[model samples]
Target: MKDFKFVSKTQETLKIALINFALLLIFVELGSLGWYFVKHKQFFYTREKTQNKSDLGINLEGVRLNQSIVERFHPFFGFIQQPSADFRPGFKVNNYGFISPYDYPFKKNKKNQFIIGIFGGSVASDYSIFQIQNKILPQYLKQLPGLQDKEFVILSFATGGYKQPQQLLILNYFLALGQELDMVVNIDGFNEVALSNLNNKNQINLAMPSIQHILPLTSLANNSLSTKAMQTTLRIQENKTKINQGLESLQHCSFAACDALTSVYVQNLVNNYRKDVVAFEKERGQNQQDDEGSVIYINKNKSVLEDSAAFEQMAWNWAKSSIFMHKVLSASNVPYFQVLQPNQYYQTKRVFGEAEKRIAFNNETPYAKAVELGYPALLSKLPNLQKNNINILNGVNVFDKTKDAVYVDSCCHYNKAGEVVFSNYVGSSILESLRKDEARSKKK
Candidate 1:
């Protein structure tokens, strides 16, 4: 009888334990649901819409895009152009990894195909190679008589954030690859001027290292995640707003404290989510600091160290590079022209509209002072550029006399009207040079 009583007591203890365990689980589920309701205020919530990775258009070399379809990596100049990246409408990368719609290995059916390669920075890479071929340069060229029937293939190697050396490297690549280019036109100034000023403190050259190497703080994967997190945060804020609106419409069961509590809770959740983002950015910044070898940031204790010498040296380097390019093209029997593109920073004249004025004179950027210090140095080398028999178009004062707005932005990126003006000048220059070449050829 005593053994039976002990067994019965063991059964009773097991039952009590099971009952308590079930109660604990029920409470946990209730708490989770309550937390969810507090945070979202809705019984059900839909996920926020996000941009597809393919939607982000192409950016090459040191330039970056929010979304990318980058596939190939180049050893020398960082990333190569992504072929057939149709991320945006009317934009296509050709098979040769250029921002062109036409297949490369140009069809040699047309003997008089006047192939010209254009190289520069963001200005050149504004849209795509196709844009230049079909729209920009062609629009101006068509207007000039006798250029209508010429089969022209304008190969663009311009990339945003690229500098002089980078542009030269791209030209060298195509030339080395046995790609036939008749004339090469380079349009640049802003990137050279801006990069030199910004990176001088780093003691690095005007051109940046590879995009991956330069921005090592955040990986592409992490950047995507950060973007999604921001989207989610926006969704959460929207939900909170909706919840507040709904609360105001309710008749009420003494919900003042509850309303306050819910608002505080949602805001706290939002704050906490934001804290994670801040932490991620901080970590990335720390990583960037750690990888300073690639970036080369030398902190000089300069209360007052003028960048005049640096600017002079940088401009000298630019001139020397230009001279070298002149030799390369001359040896190859290819005509070359370098256009010293204008910048809004140096334009003291009222060339900017209301919007352009804001972009040009924004003191937040250091381009103003850089242009002030660097353009003079660049101008000083024009005599040397002229002496070397290098064909150059000094566009620094191209818009000085014009009344219409020339620059669309402070960085001196041109608008359609601006492009028409610039391209017309460039086209006229090319035609004049070609005529001179033909005359020289006939004399020979």
Candidate 2:
């Protein structure tokens, strides 16, 4: 009986010990969770605020919600104007569409003629003196004998770093505002792939953070992190300062020791930027097909159009956006033309430097592949466009390297000389098209 009693007591003690251990574990877990919440409260709050302040609708004018100010202006001179000369540098917001600044507002006349608007990135926005003097298509068109009375307004609406979806958004915005346009010309290639990877879908709706606002905080934090890490690492090394000073001396110590230390420290910060980018892309969704059977990569949030199916959904999105502009102009009985700009690599493959070659392949060359896949898919849909009487001015042929061309570096943004060449080509094409239309009208 004593043995039985002893066994029972031992079992009871074991059970009690096990219960205490389990309780301890539970308490530790809860405490850890609570600590984490306390430590990251500000991060959570800021994320929540950003989410809550999400855009209600698309901003057509590229106005920022917080500042309620216009960062850029669309002037009659075919150039984007900054707020003021004294305003902060790099404050201009370029267009978010396929429109270019290659053309300017002209004196209106009673000739019920077609007015073509050109749009795209910097290639379309080439308004340098060289371009104006030699390559501006509008200038050439104005002087053409065939298009004497036919006015062609090549208003460029392309902005740097704008992607396909943003261009569509801009077209939709302008259409809503009831701007009568005849046709749209797009010179796209460089920004399509790169900006597609960024996370700024609502750029037009929100105010871009100022460079001045970011620089000071970044400098201070960088300095603090470097100072702490360096002090910790060099605490015991007697010759550490000597080595560091020698390295600094090699560069003439242009920056103070503290600055270098700060840079090293700040660069080590582990950020969730990659995670945020992934989340944004997932939210944007896949590309859609266009009327041309081309699969266009669209931000999955937008609407789909027929015949745009075969183009890379992103490319298709951009093309569809351009097509949408054409529809708007057609509805308003405004005439316009669309031009597909060539990637810079296609224009200057021979002169590319090592780094330039890599960037050309990674950044600009993919459009050619997209076009190859898109063209066959879109071939059948050409008739539908013809039915709409939309004159498609395909400039992809101009990208042929067999012909000498000038582009800015290895990217699609053309240099002054290149812009002039492209503009002249565009002008010639417009004149020919107008002459054909005149003949057709006479025959009718």
Best by lDDT: 1
Report how far residue 58 has shifted in candidate 1, in Å. Answer: 20
lDDT of 1: 0.59
Tens digits of per-residue lDDT for model 1, 1-444: 999999999999999999999897667556644654564454312312223322111111122232222334455655556675663444456665556545664544687676777787767765334345345555555554566777777777776556767777777776787778777788876667676666565444445532322332224433432454345445545544543343343223133334334445544543443344333333322333333333334233333236877777768767877887778889988878888887778755545567657644556555688888888888899999989988888877766666666564445576556666777677777677666766787899
> Candidate 1 — which pairs collide?
none
- Residue-by-residue lDDT tens digits, candidate 2, 1-444: 999999999999999999998997667555544543454343222222222111111111111222211123222212133322221122222233122232223223546554544456555555322332344555656564555566454444554444454455556656565544556665554454333322223211111221112222222333422343233333313223333333333233222232234333322221122222223223222211121332211123233222233244445455566567677666666566666565543332345445544433444333454444444433434455556676766665554433443543433555444565666667688778877877887899
Q: Which ten residues in a row have the lowest lDDT in candidate 1?
A: 54-63
Measured with C-alpha atoms, the lDDT of residue 9 in candidate 1 is: 97
lDDT of 2 at 52: 19
Full-model lDDT for every candidate: 0.59, 0.42
Candidate 2, residue 143: how far the Cα is off, in Å: 5.7
Cα error, candidate 1, residue 443 (Å):
5.6
